[model samples]
Target: MTSKFYEDTKVIVKDKLFEHGWGILKDLYLGETPLASIAQKSFETATGTKLATVYLLDLFKENIVAIHGEYQSQATNVLSTCNVFIKENSTANEVSNCVDDFLKNANHYIDESFSRRLFLKYGY
Candidate 1:
């Protein structure tokens, strides 16, 4: 991904994940992400070949996975992929803290640019 889009994705992911109980998305580069293929196929089925071609070829490069894997280690995946159960009685602040903790832990695995973007966006 380009630096600009990466920054934008970071902002959107942080904000939406903070507000919603479930807003995690699978990037096109990750092989282990279960949603990646499904999301790709879904887009293809809905929009024909146009979107998937751009997504798979132009937008995200498959060759980046080897380098991406080095940064996105197993511990990072575990910390970021936690399944939090938000109770009906839970306050918004409580939920925010949980998400913030997840994001803070996730900082270790991402690139410095993306990490800086998240820190600026979330102010922590």
Candidate 2:
């Protein structure tokens, strides 16, 4: 079953993100958002990691994704970190940056993963 955040909230965010013309971004998300993780070629997952979120904007009708957080295992750098609460009243710019950063991170991970495979198969 999909999370309620996914069913009800993606549209609002997709619209907002699109309207703002954000190519990709990382923004404040409530503690509960329907998001997925964009795994690295050799990525890992665990509890408390805010991965990436897949979005389909209304206007574009194409899916995009945004990611944040990091991977840490066996007590690595990210294992003990906490989600920085986007300030209760953050400025518009701060929020925008977060969203943008997230999108860029997600896209980079995704693009790199697919491109390598495509190149291997077809020599791009």
Candidate 3:
């Protein structure tokens, strides 16, 4: 059985990321323990914002990952939104940089992870 999130959401490709455009990016789990650890660290070291959403995409083929979140602090009444898109082959450092860049440029915020799930399960 494939994970619920994978079954429902389409894989995020480079074209889709381009379609979303760029903005400020503000951006886990167990037994998941090691995978979750890498994922959590990837986001934690990359951006200065709270992680609000996560998505694992391009499964089997590329294992692409994307995230959406907001900056940790804001003085205004409105909060800035951030989006990050990582290629399937990105290294740990690259993942961090990709996220950091996204948050720095994000301007608006919207809900994109309605179908996203925190757990990942795969079985034969």
Question: Could you estimate the TM-score for every candidate?
Answer: 0.27, 0.34, 0.30
Residues 3-105 of candidate 3 have per-residue lDDT tens digits of: 4343223222222333444321222233332121112111121222234323333243445455543323233211233445565556556655664565345
- In model 1, the runs with Cα more than 4 Å from the true position are 1-83, 109-124
Task: Write model 2 residue lDDT over 8-124, tens digit each, in one string.
Answer: 334343444465443333433436432333222233222222233333221212222222344333334232222222332445465456556554554444334433335445654
Q: 26-106, model 1: which lDDT tens digit per residue?
A: 554545332222111111111122111001111233211100111222224323333233333335465456445544543
Clash number for each model: 0, 8, 11
Report model 3's TM-score to 2 decimal places: 0.30
Q: Which ten residues in a row have the lowest lDDT in candidate 2?
A: 57-66
- Evaluated against the true structure, the overall lDDT of model 1 is 0.32
lDDT of each: 0.32, 0.37, 0.34
2 versus 3: better lDDT goes to: 2
* Cα displacement (Å) at residue 39, model 2: 18
Q: After superposition, how far is residue 92 of candidate 1 from its true place, in Å?
A: 1.2
Q: Which residues of candidate 2, in runs, are more than 4 Å off?
A: 1-13, 19-85, 114-124
RMSD of each: 16.7, 12.5, 15.7
